[model samples]
Target: MTSFIRVVKNLLPVILLVVVASSAQGADALPSWSEGKTKQSIVAFVERVTAEGSADFVPVPERIAVFDNDGTLWAEQPMYFQLLFALDRVKVLAPQHPEWTSKEPFASLLKGDLKGALAGGEPAIMQIVMTTHSGMTTAEFDQIVRDWIATAKHPKTGQLYTKMIYQPMLELLAYLRANGFKTFIASGGGVDFMRVFSEEIYGIPPEQVIGSSGKTNFEVRGGTPLLMRLAEINFIDDKAGKPVAIHQHIGRRPIAAFGNSDGDLQMLQWTCSPPGPRFCLFVRHTDADREWAYDRASSIGRLDKGLDEALNMNWTVVDMKTDWTKVFAFEQ
Candidate 1:
């Protein structure tokens, strides 16, 4: 039986080797993304950047990656979180401002006519935000946001708004960070609003988030210096403003960028236009059953011009219907 024991011992090493190789292969494969050209391209690009001894291997500091919020990182379907906040603000302030009972947008909002409420366009939206978000200290505003997020439930899904974040995108963020990449969120949403839960939700800190911001004044309040928010618009971080915000906030051009819709087109163009190793990805919402299916026609997060440019620029387009196995964390 000595020969039998020797044979078993000899096979053990081979078995161990096979198991290790299989695990390594699995690690390289992102099963979360479906088997297709898009998935293949994403993996290839990541491998090129991450592979040691490769010419395209970017160092940590230079490996800055910027992602657009809203439809890219999370689900911005039915309506945006900021719009919901505006609606809630309208509700709260309705009792105080009885004139809103006869106002166009406010009356529509009170009557639950979303379409009518938004008919007044950007001007109306800004009015809602200014009225609700202004006249408070930054700290008070932050606290108000915190309180709202803690109790706010999505109007249609009935789920906590934070829980609606895409699971695959969350995984992607972790994967990028694990590969020594620093990710930042450059969104059109209010900076304070995003800073409220970005760290807890996406592992992105407040400093890493750049968004539309209001003017603030430095003042000594009671015992310490405080930055009081003024009732004036400072920067609107959208469209062309995206690249400027990136440059001002990050002080460096990003090597990688991810976004959805035309608002982020400029940011992606800025990243990929440079003569160097760069990667840009556009998250396409094509899943109807899971979360949402929108592209050309949607009022919010419309992916028209950006979609055309993505094809022309050879950017990786993540097809939500095929690429992702799951959408939101709450889905599973």
Candidate 2:
């Protein structure tokens, strides 16, 4: 063999090894996540928890990871998506209820005075929700929510609400699942409303989701059994209620929790307060240019209390602008 040909053949194994190593590295667990401390911390935590015979290793069944939907998995800015659905439903049901034409909040809403309508606070908002959400079968409500989310566009962004989900989070969820973690969504959004799309959007089945809910009754309609939605409030799964709902639904405590608002404080606390190894994450909405930049002052998904506790407790806080290279899947 020629000297030059022999040299090329001798280097072939090294070149192939380099290509294989590069390919493995390129297949990152969190592609949208930048190479930073945040990513390193997450990877290290997962490794520790999943490694066989490791001190922090958790069983596959006990690898529960809970995530808040709004502002955590997706955008909640402008307003909660459920509230927007309620508003749209009100418009659709307006002609049926002529009383809304002269009502306080409804009248303002019908007149395009959104600010005035929401000025009455939770009471008025509840009124809208009960009126539009109730008096219908659970199946009917599900269809309504599904239909609305399919077509509704964010007032400002003009993009589908589901499209606003953080891209890095999708990768995180998949990564955790790959490591034998069972992911769930624990949010303050309406349970039925979220169930309409949670499985499709987040890969979380309806049974694994915990959220606020209203009373329901079994009724016979056209000789078929149906669950009729009631106006009475059954539960509010926000703030302190998050942990309560988690206990009621999930039974065991989550080893990891992810959220973006003060409403999720209790859930994160519950996850991290235990003695064993745990992970708590808070998504800081800091990318105003790419998405939104609000925390303390925002009426929707306010992160003030959670932010303070996260810093003081040393919980992982993901800085959207710095830690994430791409905010949305669409960007990639």
Candidate 3:
């Protein structure tokens, strides 16, 4: 019995070392994030805010984190996903709108010339939006968006649009929520449009999303009441408008903000301006091999002004190529 006990005790350290190593590996909350200052800053911020009895410890209810949808949570290269949806919608309805056969922008769209269609700028884009999005009940519009997103493929990558969401951001969202932070999306895309996929893809509920919107009216049709969409601008949730929408919808200032474009500058400034602990991060697209590489010169999802402000404000900027081990979840 004495000899057997001596042999068992001799192997104990090896067993303990394996268990300790496994526990340490399990402690990493953001596995998709590569080892760098960007990831370190993110983890440190969360730790400081959540540590009990610490000076920077924030209460659960006050741990609000707002994230922008396009270019932040998902890939917005080539063009915004919402714009793609709108274009596809136009094509689907083109057979009915025969007048579009000779129209300027619509004619270009029908010919699959996305560049020519958008050449007219905001006026041309708004025309497509109004034609496709308006004149339907809210429920009908919801169904249309749901159906389109389920099957639509990104033109370049050939992946479903939802599949292009950043894996690192997905880990970040789940990590924040696990730590009692309430996550909300403040996007420039249409509000009703985002609500369709926000819950399914990001685990954010419909009410937690705020975005650009058009006017709607409550009406009863054949004893059934529904909200009818209108063809007029209601609110634009980009640039300075982001902060205003945050104030109106959230009713409290966010403690952290994440985004990727000049449009998100005001939102990040609002989040980090107050005299308190806050976090602001912008995702920089720098991977040409795996994803896109564009910033200052790009028309869509421009990051010029936001990049300058992020540097001046000392906010963390995540380089997609370096800060993340993998860009898409499927890569894992």
Candidate 4:
């Protein structure tokens, strides 16, 4: 008993030190975010809405925050990661569909001529999307996506696609959730594809993820119920569709919105325009060294009008190069 008491006495200061350090860490919720106005604004907004008795205080149930996935939550440099996934899926599925060897976009893809494959424009892209995303049970598709994302690597960084998620955004999501905010994904990526990984990566469940989707057909095969993806267009959740989807899915206006491109402009506008305390933030990809940097002219994740509006409206704009202490989780 004496020895145990002596040991406890020795460890008491260390335990207290650890507790104090943890408290300090928790005090600054966004550790990956650099000390700047952008970070300050985010922290301030969260505090204002979460503080009890404050005029801007939002009820816990109404503290909704939506985030765009691709370029906002993760890197979408060379192209959207889902497009890369589709290209890889084509290569894997080509043996089963030998006709793809001669098909225009498929042929170009199989020949490693990316430019040629996409040159046909939306029609070509739709064909690719339909070919890869349809004709499978939701469970089967989920497993396939799970398998692919588990091993897929980003072309430029060679990091696992999951590892490419932005560290700062991850912290922000956690910070908001910690403050009683319900974080959701409102992205342009495929709903099924993003659902498979959103919860694991962003702490958002499948139902909370809103995005472009292919149609699904309900069927019962041999007493087994299943929903099979179909090769047809369904609702697209992008640009103007974001607020509409949010209304349909969440049934409440979000207090905060985060995004990176023109596709997100309307979502930000909708979130901030309501007659209540609101926060809108756009992430500007400005770090060419740490990550690819392109805006306005970029084919993928183009910021264009969103950047202009954010500047004009005085909405918080996070400069990835200036605001983030680290880009990827792997950096730490």
Candidate 5:
């Protein structure tokens, strides 16, 4: 053939090599995560543990990873998403509970005064949750949560609650799972409420999700057996309760733990304290432009002691503004 045609054919392999290299580079497991120590630490930890014959190599069955919901897995700013669900529920059941119109927290919620409703702290939140979440069968409550989560939108972002999940975290979960790690969610969020969307949104099944829960009792309603949710707390899986629930539900200590606030400090301590290789990650919400910026002083998802401890222990604390190339999946 001509000299020009021979030259093009000879250069094809070099061009192909460049294309292959570019493709491999673009195939990052965490596209949403920026290249930094925060990302490197996570990748390095997974590699060491999953590598055969490595000192830190952990067996597949022993490779359990737990994540906290709320601010950890999804957005919790503008108040907890569960609280928003309860508030909407109150309006739906308003005609039945006229007394709520005059109640302290309920009244404030009905009047769109969120600050006043939350003034009573945990007690007020508990009251609202019980009122809206109880007096129904477990199946009924499940359907309610499913329906609400499917349609609910964050007031600030105006995006569906599920869409508010951190894209980087989703990548981490998938990457870990691909490496034979079993992922679980241990959060302060209500178990049933989270179960409704955990599998759908995070690829974590309901059985793998552990959270705070209310009491439930078996009953024969209309000749059908069912569990009736009671208006009382069975467990509050936050702080110390997280470790307890993980122990009870999982029956094994996890090798990795992820959380964002003080509520998750105990879980992190428990996971990393044992004499073995462990990974503890704390996602610090430092992006006000893309998401939110709050830590020590914020009423919700406050990261006070956890922040100090993370530094002292040299635990991985993700600076959202720095570590994450993108926060939510909606972002370009």
Candidate 6:
């Protein structure tokens, strides 16, 4: 019995060594990120969480990572998906409202003058959204989104709207899943808008997407209890709304979060506020040659306060121009 016990004890150290070595090797195999502190920090954090017997080791279930959809997983310009929907809506409603032919933004939109339409600013955008998104049931709104993505093509690239997703972000999503991390899209975009293609494009299912939502009501339709999406805006999951949405929907604060604008600041702040291993990443669109690059002043995907906060917080900021080997999957 003593000899048997001695043999078992001797084998245990070897087993532990093999396990540690294997874990380290696995962590080392992460995709080749850009050479910088951001890359190093990501690798280190992942290793700490995944390493066996490590104090920071997190189980697969608890390894929740959330990412902002627009500008993080996909492109947000020439405009947001909701904005595109609103634009399409404006065109559809134009026939009924003949007066729009003479209006400022509507007149511009009708003439395919995107610049003029956008020049009217947020009020103009809200008017478009209200006209289209409101006065419809949830199912109808979802169908509208589904139909649009199915047929819509980007104006400049002439590529299907869904094809505009960032390639590196997609690879990162896949990599996280492989590492036993549960990835989610926490965006300010509409929930229904994202759910349409999130699964097909990002491999993240509808349930994993939490976003802005209109008021919903449970109604008996044909003796069946159906959830109806009302046009009344219930939440705007941007800025401060992001953290509130995260708490209400996800139930647990994300250990890792990725975002690209000031809209994501509150979410990142919330994620980092908790006492535990955490990481926050900001995707800075600095590659005008490869992708669009307008930060502080850009009307879309504005990154002013968030950029400064990222610097102060020591958050990983991904420079699209420098860090990314490729921007879009469709890019040659």
Give candidate 5's root-mean-square deviation (CA, Å): 4.7
- TM per candidate: 0.89, 0.92, 0.92, 0.92, 0.92, 0.85
In candidate 1, stretches whose alpha carbon ends up further than 4 angstroms from where it belongs are: 1-25, 102-104, 221-224
lDDT of 5 by residue, 143-224 (tens): 9998888888999988999999999999999999988999999999999999988998999999999999999999997899
Residues 77-182 of candidate 3: C-alpha lDDT, one tens digit per residue: 7888888888888888988989998997999999989789899999999888877899999999999999999999988888899999998999999999988999
Which residue runs does candidate 3 get wrong by more than 4 Å? 1-26
Clashing pairs in 2: none
- Give candidate 4 misplaced runs (Cα > 4 Å): 1-26
| Candidate 5 whole-model C-alpha lDDT, 0 to 1 | 0.94
* Worst window of 10 by summed lDDT in candidate 6: 24-33
lDDT of each: 0.87, 0.91, 0.92, 0.92, 0.94, 0.84
Residue 288, model 5, lDDT: 95
Query: What would the C-alpha RMSD of candidate 3 be, to one decimal place?
Result: 4.3
Instruction: Give the best candidate by lDDT.
Output: 5
List all candidate RMSDs to the true structure: 3.9, 4.4, 4.3, 3.9, 4.7, 5.0
Clashes of each: 0, 0, 0, 0, 0, 0
Better of 2 and 5 by lDDT: 5
- Lowest summed lDDT over 10 consecutive residues: which window, candidate 3? 23-32
| Ten contiguous residues with the weakest lDDT in model 4 | 23-32
How far does residue 143 in candidate 5 sit from its true spot (Å)? Answer: 0.9
TM-score of 6: 0.85
